[model samples]
Target: MGAGTGPDGSSRSDEEWERFLRESMAGAADAPKEPSARARDVAKRLRMDPARGAEGWRSYTPARPKRRTGWYVAGLLALLTLLVVALAPGRTVDLFAGDDRDSAPLAGETARPTQAPPAEEAQRPTAQEPFRGSPAARWASGAAGITVPKARAVGWMSTAEVERALARSRDFLVASSLDRGVLRGERPEKAIALINPHQRDVQDLLKTAFRTPGEKSDPLLLFSRFRPSQARLVGSVVKTRGRLTYQEGERGALQVTADVTFVYPVTRADAGGGDEIVRTIIRRELVMSWDDPDKVITKPGTFSIVSYKYTMTNGGCGAPTGYFTPPFGADRRADETDREIDPYDRSGPVGGGGSGGDECARATRS
Candidate 1:
């Protein structure tokens, strides 16, 4: 028989044999011949049982579906994706979501506002007072009452004293001489020296006579000089007053005004003299007014006043005998004479005695 076939002659050999054996064992009259014990044992040992023939050995339990690893892998991939999204900057994650378990905090979320500090304040200047006045006022006032070393007194000097003073004056001038020859065509050294010795004493007298009481020691006289040609021993007097008015506006600032006047003997000597000599008198008047208590609140450093009338007499002298009029007046008549001797003009005219008469005659004759 073939390796897959049974030894029986029947085509269904294994099945027929199994049936025959069952009937023989039951003792049925129509039973077929039973398979020999040796043959049956041989079939069982060969794993060729007729009952399990045709069908091969197989698992007894129901076949299980193939386990799907793809689902688990996909779930793991989703979890990774969620983790990446949560870890990214400027992103928020929900830990309580039905599918996810992990979540992380966002970056740059707790922001706050900032502020700047305030600036410091500015400082202001302070005011101070000196013996004469405030520094600004002092400069503004110019040379009010200062005295130089060689100045003379206001009284008349004796002949001998005058000569001695003149000599000393010349020496002082020589020491302090300046070379103005190139510019003015005249050597001012000689003229300046002529009055140097008497300058200080004379300045003292002027300060006392013209400046305000507290202002008497000011430096005003430094810029002034005595005009000998206009000097005279005349009996005259002068009175003056000054007032300071401050006009404060939108900005922090001040302005000042000064007014002054004079009353004196209208001497013939003062009239014929140069306007420069007369101007000195007016300047003195103004200086006096600046220091007047009733006019200005005199202090060392704080006040400044601009002189309104920086001129001699206001107009012409009312007295006919006077040679020159006040600042605003016409010149005096040449014929009128209530003579007051000019100390500087010691030499009389060619024919008589008046200041500049001889020079006038010479010019006319020429």
Candidate 2:
């Protein structure tokens, strides 16, 4: 047996020699001449081996350029068309599809009805109601009633309401010729004893002023007319005071007190025989006492007392002039005497006396 045999019964080495001869003869016939010395030197430096050098010299053939279809452009146009359709108005987008249109009127179609004027605005009373049951109304009624009228006028009363309020007050008015003579200062003790059957001595002087027809019966007006000559008498007094006291078994509560003072000038008719009888009446103080009602007693808040003062000169009334003080702590001290504040000086804060030193003097001289 031979080492390795081909189909021709020749050795494998003999076959290989035949194949190499054929390639060498073919290459020698078609190839160009040898390179220059520089090329030879470069090829030697590159360490080219005939078998491996074929790989290094092989050329690269690029793939065919791909054809572009119009599908991508069409797809982009389609996407833009879809976006336009989605965003355009009048597309019937149902944001509130379940809403019932038949149940309510359109906002723009209906108009609102006009409102009627207030009762006060439409019809003013020929004569104002004597007392409005408010402090402002009471003050206004008092001021207007005491002033001389533009023309003679009369005020009406139901007689029922007056009697009711009087009953609550435990007082009544009685007409007496002897009592009427005494208010003009004929006999002081006798008139005082006569009309003061209820023993409300303070009210006896007031009744004398209203005894004339067409004048409203009001304590404030009565008091003002009873004293018509003093300068200090022009202002109204609002009294404020407070006390902290412990009770038997409970915690201490703040007790607040308020009173109104009215001064009237004495006319010749009010004072007979030259007696300087200026009737002064101090309204009973209204008191409000409470615990930490809002539970805000611990916080710093102010309790205030406000007063409105007006002047009556030459039978005409003046507007009210007033002031307000800001918030303060619960432990602050309040003085009733400080109510006589100066109207001119704005530098001194309220609750503190300003140029009030001459007020007493000014009042006395006027």
Candidate 3:
């Protein structure tokens, strides 16, 4: 506004002129800012976590402590002790260390080479060993094989014996009543024969949904359905294995039961060239029956699985009803039972199935 006003109120000195230009340049530029809290946290975490870093061992290793006294003498003694231990006969203790005995060796006796100790006898793994196995066959039967898994038994049975049976059973089952192995140029009767060959009931059961103990389609074919043209269990775990518990069933028949959990994660080809995993978990019991407990006890493969039941605890794409046969009704939906659930007791029976039921339900069990 003045005739000749300097920007800084008075006429600009050389120093003031330089300062003004520098201030103007600084004002025109963007403002500097401190890093956000999240960024700072990430940086701090990176400095602490070795996985987030690639430094050498020396970078993280602590520095050596100051030297201590009497170390050389102790080390020398240790070295001498080690030499003595190494040279000692058969790695055994010397009972006559200081005794002056003249029993070095006979004049003409030659030295014998030391012999290694014999290997320890192999023993069966205890229950403490992880039960690495399948749960298909032997477990479905009441028999836990010749050897009692309960300990103090004499027999050689691997933990995974049941798994082998499951794998075999799954592969031999017909895909469906109509979609028999005929697709592979095999006869229907021949396909039936492949299932058990020894047992007619089992063979009949495998051929169709018509013969299931529930009078529905065979669910064993669930895995078999993917075989041949579609997919299979290889490169995946398709077997079922779990712990078996037992109780008394109708008419003194042993209810060899399992709340066992089985997981099978299968890899199959999609429409594209890449593959995807189809994972499933089936938690149920296949109630196999045998009137003569001895037959099953002696040769368990002879046991016949009459009915299979599915609990609410199961998962996957398998249908819960209609497709599966009428199970013991023991595995009926818990909500359908007419009982009140106790809030305090987590282990209490789920109430739903009423004591008085349909006459047919009573007659079926009767």
Candidate 4:
């Protein structure tokens, strides 16, 4: 018979096989105009040795033996053509051609949180919800976050006296750090009044700082304040968080310490019809002692400040104003110190020396 016909007369000559393949391929819409080198070799090998080539593909043949060879070859050619289209370079076909829904997250899986792009996340604050992208968003507002510890008798103080001391400490924190009036460049009278009147030097220093604020006399040392003309408070709420603790000290005094962080949202005075909000974070740690009334002549309800330290984040450094000069827009300056500090960190020792040099360092966050 012709060239290489099967024993059952099912195979066709090379010319007839080529003609049949061309007719069959005409129906494949995605078939390449020309077959690949590998495809041509496969076709040549199959035509030269039909029985060996077709042996593995017999089960896929639904036609009778007389027509099985053509049908099998045609099916394989179509499959290979489809694979070529898929693997071709610079060619792509979307499986979900017309679907409009986002396919980023699979079914039953939570959508990933949208991350703020670079130069957008930490560099600025949101306007509508000032704390939305910050950890302080979940923090309690104002005095609520300054929680007083359970009072217990320490040294010569009774439980009632200890409770009063703790309550007074919390009040001072509110007055100096969170009070709306105090934040607006107003004097922190209540906070300063809580201090012992016997500390003439301390009182004098505070008076000088507020009266004539300078590099050496910073009012920010004792209270959080901002110039009213420079900043407009975004909202009435101020986010705060921290802890209170007490212990016995030398001379039978109750040493009460408070470590607190406050977050304020404000807009520039000239931010007319604009939505630019800046968050100023201040972390203050104060150590105050109440002497035993029975043993020493101490004020009835006043506490003597032993030491005070603070970390100001997002506040304009190098400015010697009575109020905090939080950087806004072009007013942002490069950090004066290389040490990176996180304002939220409270595990370290409180009321200690800062990262050196003007107490200014880069904040890891707002």
TM-score of each: 0.19, 0.17, 0.31, 0.63
User: Which stretches of model 1 miss by more than 4 angstroms?
Assistant: 1-226, 249-251, 266-308, 314-331, 334-366
Cα lDDT of model 3 by residue, 173-285, tens digit: 32222232432223345334333244565555555543332324544322222333333232321333333333444444443333232333333332342333332233344
Error of 4 at 84 (Å): 50
Judging by lDDT against the true structure, name the best candidate. 4
- Candidate 4 residues lying further than 4 Å off, grouped into runs, are 1-124, 333-337, 350-357
Residue 65 Cα positional deviation in candidate 2, in Å, after optimal superposition: 97
Candidate 2, residues 103-126, lDDT tens digits: the string is: 221122011113311122221111
Look at candidate 4 and tell me the lDDT of residue 3.
Answer: 46
Clashing pairs in 4: none
Candidate lDDT values, in order: 0.29, 0.27, 0.33, 0.72
In terms of lDDT, model 1 sits at: 0.29
**Best-to-worst ranking by lDDT:** 4, 3, 1, 2
On residues 153-210, what C-alpha lDDT tens digit does candidate 1 reach at each position? Answer: 2123333533343344323322221122211122234433333232355436334532
Error of 1 at 183 (Å): 27
